[model samples]
Target: MTGACRRARELVSDACARWHLPELVAPASVVLTELVGNVVRHAGTPMQVTLTLRRPYLQVAVTDGSRRDIRPVPAPDVRAEGGRGLLLVRELARRWGIAPLGDGKVVWALLPAA
Candidate 1:
């Protein structure tokens, strides 16, 4: 999981640099990490991370081999140690959602890149 987050962050950082949207590197990395973390904790399946430049937004998504529904908790129990990752992602990203695919689902977040 750590390695996956590392590589995914590197990919997001590299993409931001290539696109000259350096300001997005940090938040984008965090959002990507949370998205990846969700898969590691719940899906436990091979995942695909994608970073897409959509003009003013950077679309970060993780496609996992689990078809289960993934939803963010508005306000997780304060005493709980886990389950706040998606909440963090929701707070950081401008917009985020999940899409069901044939064999799995794609969780994505759109962060302001401009």
Candidate 2:
């Protein structure tokens, strides 16, 4: 999980640098890290990460082999849900959500690039 997080951060840094949206690296890294961490902790299955640039927004997505409910913990006191990873994602990200993809699911966050 540690290695996966590191790699995901590196990829995020690369994407931000490539897109010339250096200001987004930090928040994007946090969002991506949280998304990946969710996959490692909850999904526990093979995952694929994607970083996409859409004008004023940067979308970080992680597709994992889990269809189970994965919701963002926007509120810090949501103990009945899970950890605060998604909480951080909610704070750093402009918007985030989870969606079913094939037999698995894809968790994503949109960070402002502008």
Candidate 3:
């Protein structure tokens, strides 16, 4: 989990730099970390992370080999450590959703681009 989260952060940071959108590095890192962490904890299967710049928004997608749907639940307790991944994504991303894939699903978040 630690390694995957670190790598996800690096990937988002690098992608922000490569795309010349340094302003998005922090939020992107947070969103990717939460998404990838969720995949690591729940999916327990091979997954892929994709970063794309789509004009007015930057899209972050994590595809995991699990057919189950992911719904962001409100944190039951504010002090709890768990169950806040999707909530963070929901708060940060302008728009986010999960799309069903043939064998699994792609959880995606879109952050507004300046």
The lDDT of each candidate is 0.91, 0.86, 0.91
Alpha carbon RMSD to native, model 2? 2.5
Task: Give the TM-score (vs. native) of candidate 1.
Answer: 0.94
lDDT of 3 by residue, 79-100 (tens): 8767877888999999999999
Q: lDDT score of model 2?
A: 0.86
**CA lDDT, candidate 2, residue 4:** 99
Clashing pairs in 2: none
lDDT of 2 by residue, 15-104 (tens): 888999889888888888888887888789999999999977898999999889965355566556657787788778888888897899
Q: Residue by residue across 1-114, what tens digits does model 1's lDDT show?
A: 899999999999899999999899999999999989889989999999999999789999999999989764778988988878888898999999999999999999999877
| Local distance difference test, candidate 3 | 0.91
Model 3: pairs clashing at backbone N, Cα or C within 3 Å: none
